[model samples]
Target: MVAAYQKLCPETLDGACRELADRDPALDRIYRERGCPPLWQRRPGFRTLVQIILEQQVSLASGRATMKRVENAIGRVTAQSLAGAGESGLRAAGVTRQKALYCTLLARAAMDGELNLGRIARVRDHEALDMLTAFKGVGRWTAEVYLLMALRRPDVWPAGDLALAKALQAVKKLPVKPGEDVMRTIARPWRPFRAVAARMLWQEYLCRNRAASAASG
Candidate 1:
């Protein structure tokens, strides 16, 4: 349950990274050997959330391509533009039918003043997740992603993320990818600093992947 005002900045994230390392020696070794993770913060707003929605179950490159085209088509990603763009136009913008439907629902909600992101930020994490997910297209993973990066909630661990799960598996040397329950149990020790640990693991995941790619090349 993260309070809005208790968001993590770069300085706080640095302290949190150290705190996490101290709690887990293996994670500590990563931190000591590799550099610290970035404070992955996003501005809380409609456009950002919309971008996140476009990113669902897709590669970042794919998501960005779609988002850029959509933004170009609409000139903006506001409720008015989205609602006015219509389904065909959105499809022309490179989004799937499912995503267009999702965009429509989100836009209507936003325009109707149904989704109060700012107020929700002040509430508990579950409450915030609930409020966001109550709308169409937003799920637990999406909601948690918003909480972790957009709202900068300290304790959120989006276990549903494949990247994070894979990273955790590789870092912990698990035989197989852990399920949500297993991920939760493994993440329990990180507690309030789970987001920080997640950031570190994500960085390590990318670093190792890049090295592997380079070696293969």
Candidate 2:
């Protein structure tokens, strides 16, 4: 898939820009200002989903720390290891109580053959979402993130993301950050490459925020 992305890079970026520009004129300016970030490649299978679970509601650095502890302690991020780990052990590995329970449930489900990671890759977005969200800790956001980052699905969008909302608001000169419905409407044209647009928006957000901070400083 990474190889395919490398091959299709030009078409992908061009297509994304065309769609975004068609959606709103400001998207052209944002694209010109921000350019593209490194393409996010997925690590195949359950480890990526496990990492996504660890990322929920936490800073990326903190999530990385927690993931590192989990990996070091359990030697694998499989459902079996997560299910087998004692509560004390998981707590020591930096998992929150809620997350620990979720992880345990996920592990048990996987071990019991209830959740099949391999089969997930073959399904469409809605089906994939349904399959994953059936698990204890996996919600719409987490499942969407998994599909976008891990599955490398082109059309996926995280409308619930506050950062995406802010980016859209700033780029489109909206009076306030758009809610999910507005975002969905604004993002419609970007369809298949919405994920790429999302990457561009995030880059724009970081650049603008940094500039603002520097100016204030």
Candidate 3:
């Protein structure tokens, strides 16, 4: 289980925002303007893990649609069910061939006890990340997201996320999107509250998108 200090609640989010505002003017502006970001939490398990896998390189809406189809097809998104689905069943659920392979690999690993998520739940962040990433289809981004959204880890930062980079650029008014290294560097100041900072960035991105859509409409 995650430590209470590491988990994000409304109180933690507020606390993080206050600390961020004290340290950085840009983040403070976001806190004052956009209000607090949502407590975006997910249940930590096979379903969420596979959903994150489907989210790779896709829009959030698309990922959610695909995950819905997968859930409909299998009726239960578990190791056994996913293992039984195989590639064809997954393909039938609108999963891409490569993603099917990746999901299957993860399912097989879980089924074979090669990867035990339950056992790793209580481990340190580094160990949890390593355990999650040891399987195929679960990269640094995926692992970090799992830690952030599902585990509610406060300090996790997914620097490789394109949306996050875009959000950062829009907030900072950068001419170009920063690279992953630059994103990581930018997040250094956020430190223990990086996940809260990430939520703020995502919220900014959403607000900007809504405004642009309204203008276009």
Every candidate's lDDT: 0.87, 0.77, 0.90
Instruction: Write down the RMSD of all candidates, one decimal each.
Output: 2.1, 3.3, 2.2
Least lDDT summed over 10 consecutive residues: which range in candidate 3? 1-10
- What digit string (tens of lDDT, one per residue) describes model 2 on residues 156-193? 78888778888888888899999999988988876667
Q: TM-scores of the models, in the given order?
A: 0.95, 0.87, 0.96
Q: Write the per-residue lDDT of candidate 1 for residues 1-217, one digit (tens) a residue.
A: 2232468888778888888888897689779978689887888988888888999999778888899999899998888899999788899988999989988889898888898888888998888988999998998888898899999898898988888888889888999999999989999998888888889988888898999999999
Q: Name the regions of candidate 1 deviating beyond 4 angstroms.
A: 1-5
> What lDDT, from 0 to 1, does candidate 1 have?
0.87
Sorting all predicted structures by lDDT, with the top scorer first, yields: 3, 1, 2
> What does the lDDT read for residue 146 in candidate 1?
89
Local accuracy of candidate 3 as per-residue lDDT tens digits, 124-151: 7788999888888899999999989988
TM-score of 2: 0.87
- Candidate 2 lDDT at 33 equals 62
The TM-score of predicted model 1 comes to: 0.95
Sliding window of 10 residues with minimal summed lDDT for model 1: 1-10
Superior by lDDT: candidate 1 or candidate 2: 1
Best by TM-score: 3
